[model samples]
Target chain A: MRNVFGKIINTKMLYEYVSLQRLLFLLSLCLSCLYALAGFTIVATLNYIGEDIYGYLFLIFGICFLLTGISSIKINKKKSVRILIFSLILFLIVFVSTAYPSSVGLQDYGLSASLTYNMIFSIGLIIFGLIGALLSLGALFNFKPLGNQYGAYFLLVVCMLIILYPLVIIIGQVTINGAPGITWEFLTSDVRGLGESGGILPAIVGTLLLMFIMFVIAVPLGIGAAIYLEEYAGGHFMVRVIKMAVSILRGVPSIVFGLFALAFFVPIFGISFLTGGLVLSFYALPMIIRSSAEALKSIPQGLREGSLALGATKWQTIRRVVLPPSLPGIITGVVLGIGEAAGETAPLLFVSTLIIKMPPNLLGMVASLPTHLYTLFGMRGGLGDEVEVAARMQNAWSTALILLTIILILNVVALVIREKFRKEF
Target chain B: MKKKLSKEHIIQGIFLLIASFSIFIIFFIFFFLFKEAIPAFIEVGGDIFSTDFSNELGLGGAIRGSLIVTGGALLIAYPLGIGGGIFLSEVASVWIRRILKPIIEVLAGIPSVVYGFIGAIILVPFLTDSFRMISGFSLLAGGLIIGVMTLPIIISISDDSLKSVPREIKEASLALGATPWQTIKKVTFPAASSGIFAGATLGVGKALGETMAVLMVVSAITRAPDSWFDIFESGPVLTSLIAGHWGEAYGLKVNVLFAAGVFLFIIVSVMSIISEIMQYRIEKKFKGG
Candidate 1:
């Protein structure tokens, strides 16, 4: 066989003779076909298996492999041959390691065990199969089979799809399941019949109230911190310390905030809206400081200098010039922070009550959306009457839908505001 | 004019006080957690590091569980997220980037409880049916859900890092006749290593500290796994231990949960410090350039 970079061999001279690339490609293709066949057999025979779906998959893959292998034999490029060989070896190793089954019996291990084994084996096959396919397609890039740059763009499209497919699936599932539960009554009524019949009224009110309290407490403090770090502190040592502190605070787990609140705040303030909001404010404070600081920092130095040259004092320039442009950014930050505080469950678990009734006062324990959803889906252990479980599931989906919608809207508003201000400056 | 000057002074003073409040709160957290945890520290002594879950007060199992979940989550998240980030920064068009960026932000914005809810309703059942495990809740389920939860953080940070790699270096590599992939692997990735590491550190802190989703999907079994790396088995992580027991915990149990919180706080703090340093270096590099 010629070297990988060698000129293409004349097809007429090599009808019987296979180059190294063709041989390796054919071998890998055959192995993958066998793997797919095995999957088809198992999937078809399993009692709960979805028809002979895998059988058809195996047939289609087998045909593709044979066709590719035949086409590869006629080509004689050296670089294509090298990549094909490497991909084959990698695929062979993956197939061998993953498809080999253990000696555990079906009876002893149970159906789930075998099902897991098959699922993993199938996944390995599919991954290796794709890698081999992509490697073969790499030849097209070398040959310029398609227009120049098309191959590159094709790979980019594939990568983009790979990232997007999972997100699409999750969003689709949530929307389909949750949309039914969202109604006017669902939005406005108190939860009743143990979350089976009542609307999510109390949870909605509680979530909004908690967000309001958190906004009241966190915005001023966060904006102050940002102003200090950005405009006042410069490169001072204390600024560095505060920056470090903010990063650490940001990294602290939401659950830890809950634990801290339970240990420190509950004893002082008791389990109420105040405690929940305070804990959530702590959870959101670092985010607010960081985003607001970024917004403040992005203001051009020329603007500040321009104000100074106009005989305005530093405070006057900041108040009149800097703060105006940066207000939108700060509001964006605050809105995002409130969105975060609204979704947090762990921090509020100790401070917020699961009471379905409306909170009588700020200090009264209140039902918030996230904690309420957690109670319905998580605290139940998923073991109950079938009807009850189904009802709870519907409620959980609706609650999740509402929560997701609120967050996405907040994020969209923030994005729009940031982009608008960003373009203006 | 004197009164106006004093007014400005007063406003600045108020802002300074407000800015300093967070630092005070941090100190307060440390003091309070330590004060509550000291008793458990004394009780468990070296046993706190044990992986044995049989002991009611020993935190070893919880610690091990936290490590397993965090490590498992990173194993799943790092490659996919980094790859996605690379694609977003290097391969995607401006339009694609614009569309995908907000999707990531939306992913990040989705509440943790919703993630847990999805896991409880969807992922748990799938795991049970696919694996035929008696209980659907397992370390694997928790890891998968938390991995998804952390993906936005990893992708956003890594994308920023990759974007920060100077355009000239990429052009230089291309000029040298390297393939786009080759240039990315050799030049762009190396240039962005510090930032990527910072992103991974941040991801690790997130996975380690995640509570609600893991609690919802993984059975809060406060036991060491049947094996050291049994992702199929149920276990209790540090965060879950606190979340599960805190409501009903009394006396030593409460202190132990606080002790676990302190342990988690320290780990997260170290990660936060490392990421902060890396970020500072990146900022300095850009400023100098």
Candidate 2:
């Protein structure tokens, strides 16, 4: 294999083996890069031209660049290193040309129809060109077989970045906006004046209380159902029905749960802590069941069999052998369910009420964190002067931050428990 | 021993009851939603599909808006999600995958309300400013936010599917002189396509059923878009319609909202069932093969 590879590289005739198709491929790549360059710089330089034509030109350029860059994959195969280098240079030109309008210089142009069009066009050009450049560079360095692999990895990296961008921005914005509002006073006093003044102590306490109630109501049922499915039940009709019902329940929108509560729980229990907790428990049940079932599944069957073989009954084996190892996973599930319930607003919309002055009793209306944030946002413009409205907005942000913090803490705890107690058979 | 055996039977019976509670809850939810919604279905009849929101309560526009927003969301989610999945399963180092998996989990754990709040505060004004629209609340904003919300589902499930492809098959392809990308494209992706499709279907269900954020970012105007591509205009979706109007809803309006909930429930249930069947089939295929 090495001798054949060496012979092919040593051949003089192979270096001159460029066909018309290859030449056209090279020409098209060059022209496409030029088109993107002209679209980015020349189009921006001629800003007074009708913006419509610029958009059309960009649309044309974007397509041209994408098509040419994509087409080069097939055309460049087994090509000489010289051609690969040329293609790399062309891609570099396209990248540098397009990077200007889409990057740091983006703000200078301000927001305009043509500017937005130009920005979108340039960004597309940058992405395609950069991918092309990476592929060609890989080929240029004698990684011919792995060139496309490198390009694929580049795309995956881009996808990861796209997924992470919003999370970073959401957390950054919430913390920056909500940090000042989270003084000691904010955590320990009653929210007054339609949330224009005072703090969210009642809301915080109510959220904890609601989480507790939800935990108490949901955990046993979820774990019991999971145990029944995992240990007790056989492949029967009831099991299938239960599984299907759980999936259906999981897909039911939170607002639908709210409507269900309004129609059923509210009429029976009225709008109180009981109603809210019941709805949230229903909301949390599917998640808890699913996760707990997963946890139970992870316990090796041999352990259960070993216990049963030693004369332990099924329940005894589960209580002593199965439950201990799976406890962390079950706890993780319960914590996640409670975390989800804590951040839920839709299920509590009609089932809970805002109580600013005091902590809510079990059978009375209560404030939950998510609903408090919602109420504050709803009252954004109706309350008073700008300052008061701003104050309300601040409280809304703080409430959001607190809600986010609790959920994040719960999630971290869940992750830690899962990792810490993960058992390998 | 007899007493202990009977106690075991009693405990099993208790568990059976607990397991069956889900079915009971599902039945009750359906019964009550139908009880409230049937009145509107009978009274308004076919007019429940009306697009106009001025005088009568109708769901046609909301349904259309829901479809449009979900379509937009799917466009954004399908590529990024599957790509991220491919990366996690096929490309990333172990430590990178470990770090990224939790980040995606945290992304999933972020509340819908926070996503909506961020959309309303940041994305709305940005869209309004860039597009020079009358208001920033549009279906596009709703789609963008919901797309992010559904990514964790699609990514994680697709990753699982891709990872489940047998290592021996991938090695055989690599041994055959196929590039890694070729192996992924021709072997791995085809094998995992059904699972990815399942993920996409579940993502559709999620995007369709998303509320709060859509309610916050999308216009409350209970009218259909002026045209097929008119996402710049504010339009209400079904979830948003039920949530936005339930505040002052009275008499028939309340029932109409319930009717909307019924449709949302039905559509999302169908999506879930289809995805569930697909997932079950995939699992069977893998285990059997």
User: What would the per-residue lDDT of candidate 2 be over residues A247-354, giving only the tens digit for each residue?
Assistant: 888888999998999999888887888898889999999999999998999999999999999999989998999998989989998998889877888888776556
- For all the candidates, what are their Cα RMSDs to the real structure? 5.0, 6.4
Q: Candidate 2 regions off by >4 Å? A: A1-115, A125-144, A423-425
- Candidate 2's error at B236, in angstroms? 1.2
Candidate 1, residue A66: Cα displacement in angstroms equals 4.1
- Candidate 1's residue-wise lDDT over A203-222, tens digit each? 87888888888889888899
Best prediction by lDDT: 2
**Candidate 1: residue pairs that collide:** A4-A78, A112-B131, A112-B132, B50-B60
Q: What lDDT score goes with residue B23 in model 1? A: 87
Error of 2 at A165 (Å): 0.8
lDDT of 1 by residue, B139-178 (tens): 8888888888888888888899999888988999999877
DockQ of 1: 0.57
- Pick the TM-score winner: 1
lDDT of 1 at A263: 76
Cα distance off (Å), candidate 1, residue A292: 0.6
